[model samples]
Target: MECPCCSGKPYEQCCEPLLAGRAAAASPEALMRSRYTAFATSNFDYVWDTTDPKYRDEFSHAANCDWMSSSLFTGLQVLAASDNGKEGTVEFIARFRRGPNPEARHHERSRFRMRKGRWLFCEGDVISG
Candidate 1:
């Protein structure tokens, strides 16, 4: 099936490998896109694993899982991305519905860093809801 990140690629060819530990994301945008897929698929472990540990002080597997479970993701749109194979930023919109609530769009500019040869999501600035 098509990727939820709207990368114009199939899920396996796009985000699965990155989220499954089979390969590293090529850039910040790639990592961000894969993360959107992880949320769309409810791959809580992948979402938690790809997050930078420094920003995860309040993070725990159970809490992350609960957070992912609270929403049903529908789509993703990468608005912009700039990477130098080291530190970079990505702007994107993720659409989802919380429980039985109406769908909403999450817009953010996310930061990423290359650590241990892998791109990890560091943090994000929420732009809109």
Candidate 2:
């Protein structure tokens, strides 16, 4: 499958290791990249798997899948990433095109949790439109 991060690489060559339970992301930025790829490919299982269990039930996989299908993520630009070994944060701009509109950007600050040596998505705070 195509890379969900819009990196112009196949998923296997890009983020598959993280999604397949073979490896954990080394940083919150890497986790966010993999998460974006998961969303693009409609890999709900990976999305759920990479999320902290505390927040997993809050994710509506079907809705996410539908939204992903309807929007095309054109690019990702990571602005900053910081990890203090256990917890981390990533700030990024995701550019997407929905329908016939021009690309729109989502600036987000994402929180990450490291549990049992794996990095999980905790949540995100939208910093700007």
Candidate 3:
């Protein structure tokens, strides 16, 4: 499959390793990038698979698909990532365009958890507009 990030690469070369359970992302920022790719492609299975099961329901793929399908995710800029190997945070801005809007930014601080050598998305705290 093509990369959801539109980086002119295949998903296998871009984010598939992380999404397919073949490897754990090297850092929180990398994991966040792959998650954004998952969102852009409406790959609910990957989204569900990478999330901490406790927070899996936080992403309602069916409800999200409508908006997700309509928008084109342009890029991701990671601002910061910190903490140790087990717990980390990543703050990033995702750029997307929907209909008449040229492109808007969605910035948030996302939390990650590493359990048994695998990284899982916990939740995100949206900081601003």
Candidate 2 lDDT tens digits, 82-111? 999899999999888889999898999999
The number of the candidate with the highest lDDT is 1
Best by TM-score: 1
TM-score for each model: 0.91, 0.87, 0.83
Q: Which residue pairs show collisions in model 3?
A: none
Q: What is the C-alpha lDDT of each candidate?
A: 0.87, 0.85, 0.82
Per-residue lDDT of model 1, residues 1-129, tens digit only = 888889999988998888778898898988899889888878977877888999877567787677688988888888899988789999988889888889899999999999998899999999954
- Position 26, candidate 2: lDDT: 83
What is the clash count of model 3? Answer: 0
- After superposing candidate 2, which stretches have Cα over 4 Å from the reference? 1-11
Please give the range of 10 consecutive residues that has the lowest summed lDDT in model 3: 1-10
